[model samples]
Target: MSARFTRPGAGTPVPVRFPRIVREALDNGLRIWTIPYGAIPVATTTLVIARGTGDDPADRHGLASLTGDLLDEGAGDLDAIGVAEAFARLGTHLDIDVGPDAMTMSSAGLARQIERTLELLASVVRQPRLEAADFARIRELRVNRLRQLSRSAGTVADRAYVSAVFGDHAYGHGALGTTRALEATTVDDVRGFWAGHIGPAVATLIVVGDVVAVDVAAAARRVFDAWDATIGSSRIDRPVVAPDRRIHLVDRPGAAQSELRIGHLAPGRSTEDYHALVVLNAVLGGQFTSRINRRLREEQGITYGAHTSFDFRRAAGSFACETSVQSDATAGAVRDVIAELGRMREAAIAPEELAAASASLTRGYVRNFETAGQVARAATQLAVHGLPDDTFDRFVPAIEAIGADQVLDVARRHIRPDEATVVVVGDATVTAEALTAIDRPLQASAPEF
Candidate 1:
């Protein structure tokens, strides 16, 4: 007799509990958060300062990014090569990133090397050698990179879209400053920025993996307690998004395909309806099987793929639908994208779709804490966004509680199809006829970069 086995049905998801994160503050106002995870004999440290490109002076855009890149180039007694060798010899890695809101420096190494890594991180943060030679070299590379990006259809569309939507707002420009702005930056400007923004008063240190909260706190105190506390300027004004919708066409002559960017300003991460809006975005275009991708790519074969997302920031963010389609199909793709946006607000999502979207969110929530570094980063984000410590704990529950009605309600309230700024980057001569069919007056311009 032969025995057969049956395939298992979908099983209930196991509940995930995040590790306890202890928060403390040093005498110099440096915030420290330690999360203990002993699964591996390794540790990770991340130091986040509440300064980024948003703090770039009005005339000196991209200064913050340049400052961040120069951190590990040299420090107290180490030159650029020496800094690299120091981490290499210890089998560790230090990475730095600057965003619109904050600059983060992170490292991972063996648990025993935690103290040395923290000391090196402290030097990079507090005593970076922003030498004139280093500044000149980095600035040239950035300018060249910007020039290269200016030629890309996608890059042109992105810059043009934000410029059109935000106008004179600080967020109008990309983090990589314009060629003119990058050329204008000086070493003194960088030093001044570091003095004013990168300090203990506006910084947070996070340590995770194979460490105790008390021990991590003591280590942080040893490294950062004596640092100066110079508070930077207050946050800039929230971007003022105008309610007018316009179709801007960037002339990228002889382009093979048209890059389409359609979006409008949306709520920040702290919105009361964040969970509902997230679920709504899923059904619209947040997932591969979303309506936008399904209709544009799978059904009509207009393009390979289409998607949408909310760029959630501390203040207001934007909801964008991005895709590339044949020049002749640009207008049709735009029409279909707008139609899907409308349907999300007007139609009730099917039960299966809602269940699938909710499941996708809740199921993936556990993966965020799979590593000590990931958990530390998540906690740091919560701190950066001023969210409650329990935010992660409540994430799954909040997503699961979202009903179809709530999705529709949030969609109706947030997704404004009429107010979206439509940007197209392609050969204007070839796409003009198809694009003008949308019934809106087309505004033509060159790439702002």
Candidate 2:
């Protein structure tokens, strides 16, 4: 007879020399952070604007994102096809990411081609032709995406939850926006947003891998220094949750599963309790072995998996648990999820749990700097949030130092079960009665999608 044993435990935490970053600025205000990560011959160049979807006019919810989609369609002397072919000729990949807080333009290619890639990116941002044909085509594609989002339970729950949490605030709507808002969007709107929000004062240029700071700055100035247009630099007011709003749902008729989002508005990215909150989330639902997942997925068998996150932006953020479960188990699953959220504040954290969570975060922290692209992305966060240059240098030790009491304090301060907003997308006809049976009074709203 033989006995089965679990796998080996995590190794002793090791020290890593995080990339030493050089911060330089153009005369016009675009910050340049160049990190020399060599031996790979590849470089990733990124340009970021501090404004993103949250900066979209309340009336024009998707303007920022739609403008991003049109950036590379036609630029400078190149038509849509020509622009694509130009980047292809350089063997570079161009990617645009528009999130709640910022818009990132990234190009990754051979180190020697980095200058040309930067030139192409500059053309897209500074001189996009913004052709009528491109706008109509891209706008239609976005409209199609919004249509499809209505049918997916996960997206339905996501949009509903965000809306419920923030109400009509700028952060309330998803980047894709509602059908009415997207349909009403015009090319003139795209051009206007481009002219207003894209500029050096609000931008940060980060170059990583096999590049020197002097060269990146020289190329950046040559391309962008003379272009000093910086408008729409206003900050987003911190969002407030609707006091009376508790539970929100979108009816998905005959759906077999229910997608749930439970959470509330929490502290922003710059909180002093950042490290403790990280450990708190790791214990709550940020990891597979977390409290919420262990209770709902491993013990009760209600969900396949469950996860939580603290989405930190500049001025504000959210703490949420997301999962999909059988429709019949929605109420019980929601109850159990809320209970675990409370448990963090209501109960003492076990020493093993604290050690495991700290290990989970610290052990793999170094992996974030393994590639040039990874470094670019990680650095983007620092620049976008106006974090100090030494953030990466302090990450592992910060997480390792979070103790049980500190995590509990952050959990109590940030995780708000009482104010939590519950969002579910499922067959409401079947879910309504059970949801109402729980201790929390339930409220329903028509799908916001």
Candidate 3:
């Protein structure tokens, strides 16, 4: 064949072939999954608990996160620093994450040290010291962090946006919570939260690496089986979009730019059209070449970049197109964003656009399992969301098979431009009059700290 001058086009992506998981469980009901992956003699261990900020009591908004922070601050035979040092010695770090629906803590290192790693993870989760001094320090840090976030325009927009959308529902509050609730929280409250919420009955252990499933189960059992504590019931909230409370503007007074969060409540993580939503978002603004990003950033040059996400969680979620634009571009950007939303609902995507979005997702699917830590975390998602074990295995093929009509259908069903909640955190002097030009009513909102 003669040399071709034009660039080559991307071919069909090879579907990801997922490994079979070795699933086990302790008598206490803590499920264990072993995902054997990678050639390196390394592994990752993770414990995912089905309790989080959403489980916080009405008056105790930030308790779950507070409890998470207290873990590893002096456990079995080590203080927080010692716990950290031990993991460092193993060539890894202990990562604890508190999300809207679950709290997950993990560590990765040599598969040879997997047993010790499990022991350390056990100490942090099952027998955290939760000393009075450590509690005070973590509480102070949370307060300081909230105070700092209050001053951040983007953070302010997020807080007000969720508050306005979810109202007083459990999902309404931010993870860090307000200073009012934090100041009222005490160390005893923390201990009570731990006793009532953390247990084997509500958790799953996932180990992925170059190791045997049986050995991993044995090690995990010795460490996690004795966590016979009773886990308390979580708060049940049916969060819906707050009606008649449309545009919320939190004035920053003379700020140079405005942070805008536009959109409303969406389906939870386990929505039936999950694959379509992924491709739909990728085609919308999930990527650099998406419609909104292209119109706002590439064409008009109003902002540096624009993006959107379907923040799917356990029970409910939100769809938002977030962007920071100059003070003068605020109103135009708002209108442009809404127009794009309407366009997505009404328009059928071009063939090339659909192909690119599908490729973007399928081609990168296997990379998620490239590392032990990544594989362990991916497995944790299955446990947390109650998804089928074949979820990852089905991802590439399902995404590749998503046709233009499916995306159009989900877009029409989900994207609500008229019902979208518009929020701006910026200089009200210019934005107030500018945003008023839009159809929705503007209501001034303040960060609820």
Candidate 4:
């Protein structure tokens, strides 16, 4: 590490320190990124492919998910049972996770097992069998999860909100996809999806804890040298923000309380307004004393709790306030929530409120990387979003730099009280009538499908 950067807080107003990940690229264009943390005997490695559900073929909404799950069933010469035993014998923890926008294959173990682990990773990504038997089992498991989600009103509200907000955008599809899509997805489709999406051009390797930077880089190169770099989705365009201001009421009979999700599209983590928006969100609905929570829950006694947040994805994400309250109180609670949003958008946040929110945000920023795993995860997120190299190092200072005016400015620009998507999951007949009687200027639309 350079000495100047080493004394991070000793100089600049917004001091920063990059994590010092060694970087290289093989002939195949697979960029290798590594961070060597030699303080412990254990190490973690993660290979993140840019392709996720966002890259799903329109007809095959569940291909990415199926591919992610089947990668661990068997690879190279190992069958499903053999792969399980190998990881178990090595005492390694391996995880495969698929999202709408990306997939991650990660593993952690003693430093001595790096070679074996790397080989396992390569095998899984390079030569998964995607056997018919394993596909049946995975599909069955996903069906069960979907079935469980069907009975949960909260789950129903959440899924409906995203689908309503994003429409046909890549993010519109849920991570656990529809049962019909899963049934239609085939092994060849999984292979083709991986070939197109999981390769070097879209790959980021993060290695942390008890490893030399050079060795980590070399390991990455050895394993990923032949992988394709420009292998993912080609249709990259700025997704249109529909910003439909409507009340989507999901009718679930016998629901005790209405589940609600409100608010609209906000800038992502990469936006220049990101820092200000963070503070603004914290003041409005991000904390216990936040205005939305205080007004809706503490003051009005409409619900036990209510809060707002921004999803902050690689692409545009949702900023939403969510809570559940008695069915009768749903209309009142949502109305109050909107009034608060309008108040926040128009008013200059009081100095005291900004101070407290800033304090909470600063405190949260400090605690964000309390664990090694968290630190690694943060790095992965930063890499994925193409954020500045010094995000973590400058996190606290960034929060401290935003004044009341800056926060209010961001709130005014992004917190759209008039355009927020208010979704309520309850008996539509009761809630719809209540909304009609309230007669607010905001228009309401019924849920379809």
Best by lDDT: 3
TM-score of each: 0.96, 0.97, 0.96, 0.91
What is the lDDT, from 0 to 100, of the residue 333 in candidate 3?
93
Clashes of each: 0, 0, 0, 6
Candidate 1 lands at a TM-score of: 0.96
Sorted by TM-score (best first), the order is 2, 3, 1, 4
Off by more than 4 A, model 4: 1-18, 228-232, 439-449
Pairs in steric clash, model 2: none
* Candidate that would win on TM-score: 2
For candidate 3, lDDT tens digit of each residue in 1-449?
55597756777666666677898888988988888887999888888999988888879889899999889788978988899998999999898889889999988789999998998888888889999999999999999999888899989999988887777788889988888999999999999999999998889888889999889989988888787887777755558545533789899988999999998888888999999999999999999989999998988887899999999888888899999998889999999999999998887899999999998888767778778887777788888888888888899889988999999999999988898988999899988997888888989889686
lDDT of 2 by residue, 162-181 (tens): 88787877888899877788
> On residues 1-449, what C-alpha lDDT tens digit does candidate 1 reach at each position?
33456633334555677788788998888999888886798988899888877787778878889988888889999999999999877798789999878889888888778888888888888789999999999999899999899888899899888778767776777888788888888999888888888998888898889987888888888988778857667575668767647788988788889999998888888889889988988888988989999999999998999999998887777899999998888888989988888888788899989988888778767777888788878977887788888788888888889999999898898999988889988888888888788877788966545
Q: Name every residue pair that clashes in candidate 1.
A: none
Candidate 2 stretches with Cα past 4 Å from truth are: 1-6
